[model samples]
Target: MSTETKEKYEKYYVPEQSPWPIVGAIGLFLLAFGGGNFIQQTTGKYGNEGSWGWLIFLVGLSIILYMMWSWWRDTVRESMGGLYSSQMDRSFRQGMLWFITSEVMFFAAFFGGLFYARTMVMPWLGGEGNNAMTHALLWPEFIPSWPMVETPAGDTTTAMGAFGLPAINTAILLTSSWTLTIAHHALIKGNRNTLINYTVITALLGVIFLCLQAYEYYEAYHHMGLTLGSGIYGSTFFMLTGFHGLHVTIGTIFLIVLSIRCASGHFKPENHFAFEAGAWYWHFVDVVWLFLFIFVYIL
Candidate 1:
């Protein structure tokens, strides 16, 4: 009986070893180092052109994008060939869950730094704690306040208004999330036309959000004097929202690919783990943007 069950049910399918993980690590290292230097140069801190930094960063990004496309294409082929069993699906779901959990922790660290800077660090530097000597010795005239536009070095820049472009971007992301939800339902109901249309609309919304963000950045740098060197406020503002924008870009690409797959009849009504995973990621991106809008923008 056991032999018969084993033969009928088929054994688990393990994937072959791949070199993408190491390649991806190398890409990330280059991206981090190059991107940091690129920022410094572009913000006038280094007074250099940042040509090499930009080149290395672009190369790293291209490699990462290529690896992702190739890896996902192979996975899609294997999935379409019916190589994945129920157990494999469960494993994929668990993997996605853990990945999202790690992403949450990643953002938590940034948020923690922001909170520490605002509540504890600034106050201590302003003579609020027992270290009056420290405050007087460093910046005796410093008065810690929200929307800190003045740095301790006497440098000043403008703080962006929360209700202008940021509010509009928030609305755009929220609508994209709704459109994606509709696309998910259409996929589940086997409405291919609606699925493709809604997914495309969602991707378009993501693009529009990015464009507005770009324009906002231009306004910050060109007119408002806000930049990477505009002190902690500008740094945190860009870091939080910049990473969110990158995630939105990735999500937009994911939706575009999923739309193409939908047109090619890749997902079925009941067995669409890939579609589910993309939807999960899109929704996560939406939620993160909401938090960013509230904490980084409105607050």
Candidate 2:
């Protein structure tokens, strides 16, 4: 082997096989199964008698959380001890990039479902295609529109227009993206104070955006009477936007962690993979929100 490869193998610290991943998988399986049972119970279908699924789900969730915390703590300790070389840093960067790319594709699947439902399914239900009798027998008054004011089931809801808190959130997220870019630039310039200030500001903006989103959800649920059970429109709206909100929450936590690292002088000007990872995640969240604002809310 080459000298560099030999050195890499020498420095690598691979752990023995651990049971955490398999245990975590079992926990997730319980969570999913229990959640399904819980939903059925809520709908007045007493499929499972004692809420055993929910209890199991909660236990599984706790185990998963513990696993993640312990695993990440160990990884951070290893990273801080100078165990990671340049090749390791590159691997981490590439791994994070590909992880974000996978997230993009995940959201893209939802977007695609939305498009297919709006352009094809709704139209076909309204007798636009080969199902003329479908309209005549079922939803004669249904109109195929993007916001889907009236569903085939005769349920109606006012579309959330783009002129309210959503537009404000768009501006907030966009400006935060700019501030985070400035923070990244400051970090590269070795201005730790400026970097911390900008990162803190960006994190605050993320908090504000999350607050605004919570308010928007309240408005939709109470004032607009648009909820996850409203219809297909409501379902799509909540699914896409809810997942994006969750990603924003995660990204904010990532930035907060990076800010703490910066304050502790953990990242140098030359080697700051943790900071870069957080920044890249934040940027990815920003881009996803931009698309959501344009397609889901605005259009």
Candidate 3:
């Protein structure tokens, strides 16, 4: 290589091959497989009567935790060692941008399915245009509806309302976003205690939100007859909110880590992309919940 190119390559910090990526992938796969099986068993799927799904899920979660600890340790060490340059900073920003973009698309697919079901599939099944004969011959009693409380097979469920727990959770998330912004501003001003305090509060708010949601789920299953198996409406409602809740859980952990790092005096006013990244992720999660509130709950 030319001397200039060789010098440029050497100037940028690139770590050696890491095992963490593969480890994380395995962890994610196991989490998905086990979680799916666990749900099936919970719902009384006969073949999984003696399944080890919950155990596998726990193992996967433990591996993921270990991977995060090790990976973050190495990255923090490298950063503290002054190995990353402006180029690396830009790379980090770009990587986060793309990651969030992919997440947007992931949720987009679910929203698309929701839209298609509501507008096209439901209408067609209810005797719209070309499917009139099919509807007449088949589901003649079926009603074109938004909530789809009754399944074609005769299972019924009550639709969750937009008020009460959902509205309270929305307020909590919005307030948490505001507090996180205040924390970011405090970090910029080098108010370490304020940063840590607000960050902890944000994480606590996330925990409360999860707790309330769990209660809501209990009410749905026991009183409202709403469940994962409760026809299309229940499935869509749970799928969207459940996935968003998982994101909130991850974002809460991210904020908690940032809080610990802030307490350790790990970031300076001018150099704190990790804090900014956590804020970005939290805001993204908050925005997704807004959409869920509008489309999945209110609508």
> TM-score: which candidate is best?
1
lDDT of 3 at 97: 94
Off by over 4 Å in 1: 1-3, 7-10, 46-51
TM-score of each: 0.95, 0.86, 0.94
Task: Tell me the tens digit of each residue's lDDT in model 1 across 95-214.
Answer: 999988998998889889889999998898899969799899999998988778998878899889889999998899889889989988998898989998998898899889899999
- Choose 1 or 3, whichever is better by TM-score: 1
For model 3, the superposed segments whose C-alpha errors exceed 4 Å read 1-10, 44-50
Distance from true location, Cα of 1 in model 3, Å: 14
Candidate 2 off by > 4 Å: 1-10, 15-20, 23-65
What's the lDDT for residue 150 in model 1? 95
lDDT of candidate 1 at residue 63, scale 0 to 100: 83
Who is ahead in lDDT, 1 or 3?
3
The lDDT of each candidate is 0.88, 0.82, 0.92
Better candidate by TM-score, 2 or 3: 3
Please rank every candidate by lDDT, starting with the best.
3, 1, 2
Candidate 2 lDDT by residue in tens digits, 1-299: 88888866635456557777787788778767876666455434365474676787688777766776676667778878888877777788899989988998999999999889888888987799688998888878776777876655566687887879989999999999999999889889999899999999999999999999999989998888787666778878988888899788878877887788778888887888888888888988999988988889888
